[model samples]
Target: MTTNHLELSGRILRSRRFDSPAGIHHTVLQLEHKSLKTEANMQRQVYCVIQVILSGERFERLTDKLKAGVDIQVSGFIALQQSRNGQSRLVLHAENVELKN
Candidate 1:
């Protein structure tokens, strides 16, 4: 068996809500993260921007709070999504979201 899980904390750079043709609600967030980490036994600064997607009615309650500039932590799985142009990118599908003080 294999497992795929990830947890990340970052500031929301952008947020948007949309409905699919089947009426499924989806919330997309662009998150920016900056932190210091130990790599190769040395301290290094890490910075990244990633896309997070929250889907279904279960995440409705948290949608309103997923606004730009809000600091939040999200726990979920990562998947590759292909766009219309056939380019694939990594996206985090959030299962849990929390506000960070």
Candidate 2:
């Protein structure tokens, strides 16, 4: 089977919970990742911002704790963000999130 897995460790930039039409609980988070990467023998700072979704029971359990500036590691799959403006982007659908100190 083809897998589209993604694991990210970063600080939460934003988090919010909302219910879907089918009554499913969902939490969306904006994660900010920053690290140093070596390119051509030079170390450069790299940064990325991504959207992540935590759904179902996990959302219900974590909604109260997850907030901006919290560090965490999330593992999940990458999917295309559905949009009406034809400007879709890649989003991570989190299966699990580990809280970090």
Candidate 3:
């Protein structure tokens, strides 16, 4: 089986909560990441913003903790989400989220 997992640390740029028709609670977060890495024996600076989805009742308790400007770490798998306009974007489905000091 192939593996698809990713872990990223970043600051929350935005956060919103909503409930599905099925009554499941969901929270979406916009995360911004900046880092430096060595590539081909050279240092490179990287920056990106990604959306993160946290679903289920367990995550509702964390809603208050997820806010803009807060630093956090999230780990999960990435998936393609299609919008009603037929546009597709990559989103991270967070299985775990932790606040950074």
Q: Give RMSD to native, each candidate.
A: 0.7, 1.3, 0.6
TM-score of 2: 0.91
In order, the Cα lDDT scores of the candidates are 0.96, 0.91, 0.96
Compared with the true structure, what per-residue lDDT tens digits does model 3 show for residues 1-101? 99999999999999999999999999999999999999999999999999999999988778899999999999999999999999999999999999998
How do all the candidates rank in terms of TM-score, highest first?
3, 1, 2
TM-score to native of every candidate shown:
0.96, 0.91, 0.97
**Which of the numbered candidates is closest to the native, going by highest TM-score?**
3
lDDT of 2: 0.91
Worst 10 residues of 1 by lDDT: 60-69
Off by over 4 Å in 3: none
Per-residue lDDT of 24 in model 2: 92
Measured by C-alpha RMSD in angstroms, how accurate is candidate 3? 0.6
Candidate rank order under lDDT: 1, 3, 2
Instruction: Please write out the lDDT profile of model 2 over residues 28-96, one tens digit for every residue.
Output: 999999999999999999999999999897558677888999999999999888689889899999988
